[model samples]
Target: MELALSVLQLAVRILALPVYVLHFLGLWSWICKKWFPHFLSRFTVMYNEQMAGRKRELFSNLQEFAGPSGKLSLLEVGCGTGANFKFYPSGCTVTCVDPNPNFEKFLFKSIAESRHLQFERFVVAAGEDMHQVADGSVDVVVCTLVLCSVESPEQILREVLRVLRPGGAFYFMEHVAADRSTWNYFWQQVLDPVWYLVFDGCNLTRKSWKVLEQAGFSKLKLQHIQAPLSWALVRPHIYGHAVK
Candidate 1:
């Protein structure tokens, strides 16, 4: 019985090898950087429009603090395709930092469409190394769907805390590890290696909130959301604010 199980696991891994090779070899990254943003831009635009209720609810927290005057300074890490641009209050200036340089083009296009916000600059830097953004420079640091894929969640959070002005908020929306009781959690563990390869290093089992807690936030608020599982690997989500 043990032998049979071993063989099955080996087979599963073998079947997933192609994705690993493509991703680690930089081919997948190249493709995603080049064309994936365009596809994601369209999908998010449609998805956000269709799911306006949920999107609005998630963004309302940001709107409350940033206000309508748009005077606040905002820094968005992993500002993919500028999905959050539409939600910013009018006149708020934004500095975007993303590791993938390919995102800059799409982000600029999205900025053009976002009349409420002003673009200060785009820095091609990872969340872990944002030295270009001075400490305590931003009133609000926004991170949506980014921590799960970063190389080190701790370092990223540290940088986040560093850059945030005292009493400034860090708003995040992240898909997190599922509850252990679920079959989906089992699958997430079993398929984690391949999933990371195919999805640009997105870990299916990261306890992102724990990382947030350990980062020493003065205040942390999180809302656990179990969205109807369209994609089993990324169904569990946490959305809220953490103050530094």
Candidate 2:
């Protein structure tokens, strides 16, 4: 049985070789960086409209984290197009981090539109390694729809912990793997490889909630719900906050 499983995995890898080649040539990254931010900007309109109430509730008390300047320092990892800017409290000093430099223009547009927020800077870096952000320098860290595509969720969470001040808050929302018995889970398992290739490394079967639960947060308030997205495969979502 083990040998059969190994053989199956090998076959899958062989089938995905073209994708690996494109990645090696940097063609896949280039294509995604050029187009994905534009796509996300369109998608964010629908997503934000649907998630407004929940986001408002989640971010309502950010004033609690405000410093002497009457503003809270916020770090947003994987901040594609700055979709969360409108949801943040006024006077937030936000530092945006994303691996793709191409998103900088769209991020600037969002920042321009969100006049209430104070733009700190935008860093081109991945979530796993944000050495650019100092230790315990941020009061809040926001991540949404990011873990599914990241190379390492655990490492990203570690960086989140490292960048947050004592008693800081980490807000997260992510689509997770479906229930084992459901047909959605079966399809997610079957389509994950192709999905990863097509959607810029997003895995449909990532159990991101499990990673967050074990991420050494001093306090965690997690809630699971079916997001009102058109895609059924990504409807199972977990959202909440964790305190450092």
Candidate 3:
């Protein structure tokens, strides 16, 4: 009887979280874009350099995925606090975007000052809005740990494809729910409620590669790994590059 009740409770646990997750997601979408900037500036470095550092090495074989790096015209959507800036090769001209109000003044200040591109804010193309950029002008579009927070993952990827030139590449790193692990499934199911609220709009189970494939990034070079600290439970991470 206790085991049956526990199973029933787990079932309820799974069904109940999304309601709150969706509700909190709405609240965070507004708060995250406006939350503390200078403070976040300092904090972003910790996450930027730490967790993102590990994820970056997964793309070490860049030549296989993104081609050569010189004279490249790249766009980074949801370029949170410019963590990915130093990772990009020198010759590449990057146009980066993030909607955070903090992003403009404090987060992307360095990006706005880059000599490589004539324009300011790099790309500043928010996921919720991508009409600002011209079609077929971009050589690479990157999303590192960003897609999990996008307002509409499907529409944002559509815009990514729209702007990228034929043969242009999409490089990405993200976390998703783990398959084959009951513990991971259980915690991802539990913490996801508070998770989406506190940590921006990031989802614990959004398989970004599948989302990319469905959005027509048909030529894909992909990798999947685990985050050292993804959730308190399952840290499933996905890393890959797809060509448009």
Candidate 4:
């Protein structure tokens, strides 16, 4: 009976794939571009609640590079909903970039709420191509939960390196590929295509940390972590800094 049910489910997903593809090509892009960041901004509150301790540590790392003096310039790639706004020190300038232009409104709201961290500008650009930003101009580059969905992780990292000044920091927190023996890993591999179709190209099994290490960062610090068991498929994560 279970085998039959599994087969039925797979057949349904297979049938849905074309529909998803069409939606992505049609109105889905508009919807995602318009409201996805708002959804993420609210979702982040609950997400932070679930991983409060980890978030604290991540923000601490951000502060070390940004510092209290706030003279630093930060360029945040995939700055969805500006969740990191409050964590930044006062006097620092922040430039937010996201492919989803709808995030601009939410980012403005976040900036208003934040006591520190001045808004520099909002750029509508993908992580793979950030030509609007000048090379070696930013003191810190931030990426959180971003690489898994980009068309080319390597290209995005190259862009990160190009934008950051020498000895500048790249702060990141990302969900990544899981251990092969785990049930979550098995399902992640099996469902990746459908998952991407539903979630705007988010991949469940990317080895993001390894990609960052190979990107020629002069210094790297990384630690693996597991999310709450409730979100099993995306449980594995890595968060740290890489200096260019």
Candidate 5:
């Protein structure tokens, strides 16, 4: 079975070489930045509704991180369409970072609607390399549905740790690989190449929790749950917080 799966995966990758070249030429990036956010904004509404309780629980401690200004300094990496803005505590001063410059307009639109939260600035940079953000400058760092797609989850976590102040928190929610014993795992491996092409580098079979565990956080609390996503491939999820 393993050999057969590897053969299939190789065949898929060979067939996908052309599309991969287009991605290399930035065609997919242009399409994703220009159009993906609109579709994601609609999907976020339903996703947020389904995961509201979990999100509220995750962000319940944001007020504890408030600085002398009586506001939490929060950084959100991969802040696509600013979808997590509504879940944040009021009075949070947010800095958004994303590789896609096109998300700025939509991010500002979300900022306008989220009157309770204050927008600091939007930085166009990848999560793994955010030199634009100063080190140890944020009280909190939030990431959702981002790890599976980043080129290096470990590097991103390192940057997350570097940006967070001592005793600061890092909150994350990510869809992860299903159990190896399950049929879902088999399908995930088979579909990963095509899914990565269509969804702009999102892998269907990343065990993101392992990266988080090895990220060198001082304290970590994580749990696995099934998100109410229409796509079965991305239903398995992990969410929790880590302290730097």
Candidate 6:
């Protein structure tokens, strides 16, 4: 069993290498960096609006913990399509990054549709590195629906904490495993193979909140919801805010 577990873990890493490689190809980068995001964001926004039930409730619940705004300096680690920033005041400037570098300049350029809106730049990098920004420089760090797609969520969370100032908050929203439910194991087991191909190594059963707690971020306010499984099967979703 131990050997099997080790192999399972190694397999996950091995599969991710190709995804990482694909991130560099300009053609595919156009897909992940631009196209997929455009479609997925639309689908998600539509779901949030048309469904108008538990999923939206989940977003609302997570919104409660978001810090009040006043030109807050924000960092979004995997700001694929820059969707959630639509809700923030333009004053809350965001430094967004992604692995795909081919994104159009305007897609990344900071724009203020409103006086409160301020966007800075879109960078081409992954979660394992955010060295461009100095530590503790940001007022708040956000990553929404991105943890699963990252290579090492545990490491990424640590990086997020490292970059955030003391007393700064990390506001994230992602799908995680349902505690103690057979669905948790079932989701990972069933989807682990195909998910790599479909979603750029995004896993369905990462227990990221537990990973965050272990990484020393405390005062977590999180909501776990079991959405009617459709897009990703047997998966549970979480949205929360935490402090480093």
Identify the candidate with maximal TM-score: 5
C-alpha RMSD values across all candidates: 2.8, 3.1, 4.9, 3.1, 2.2, 5.9
Residues 69-177 of candidate 5 have per-residue lDDT tens digits of 7779999999988889988988789999999877778888899999999899999999999999999999999999999999999999999999999989999999999
TM-scores of the models, in the order given: 0.88, 0.90, 0.75, 0.88, 0.91, 0.72
TM-score of 3: 0.75
Give stretches of model 3 more than 4 Å off: 1-31, 36-43, 51-70, 109-125, 230-234
Candidate 1: clashing residue pairs, number: 2
Candidate 6: worst 10 consecutive residues by lDDT? 57-66
Question: What is candidate 4's lDDT per residue for 1-244, written digit by digit as tens?
Answer: 4575477558758788765777857976676566567668877777767766776777675545653454788999999888877666677789999998778788888888976777889999999999999999998998988999999999999999999988789988899989977777767877776777667779998999889989999999999999764578887999888999
Question: Which lDDT tens digits does candidate 6 get at residues 43-121?
Answer: 5665545334543443343333335453477788877655565555434667887775543343443243334556676
lDDT (10s digit) by residue, model 3, range 52-80:
66655754544343444446677888876
Per-candidate local distance difference test = 0.81, 0.89, 0.68, 0.82, 0.89, 0.66
Compared to the true structure, candidate 4 yields what TM-score? 0.88
lDDT tens digits, residue span 1-244, model 1: 4475456556778998776677769788777567666767776776566445655676675644553354688999999899888877777889999988887778888999997888999999999999999998888999987999999999999999999878788988888999988877777777777667666677889999899888899999888888554576777888788888
**Candidate 6 accuracy as lDDT:** 0.66
lDDT string, candidate 2, 2-96, tens digits: 47545655677688888778888989878877878888989889989887888888888778877667779999999999989988888889999
Off by over 4 Å in 2: 1-26
Q: Output the better candidate (2/5) by TM-score.
A: 5
Off by over 4 Å in 1: 1-9, 23-29, 46-51, 63-70
Output the lDDT of residue 107, model 2: 94
Q: Lowest-lDDT window of 10 residues in candidate 2?
A: 1-10
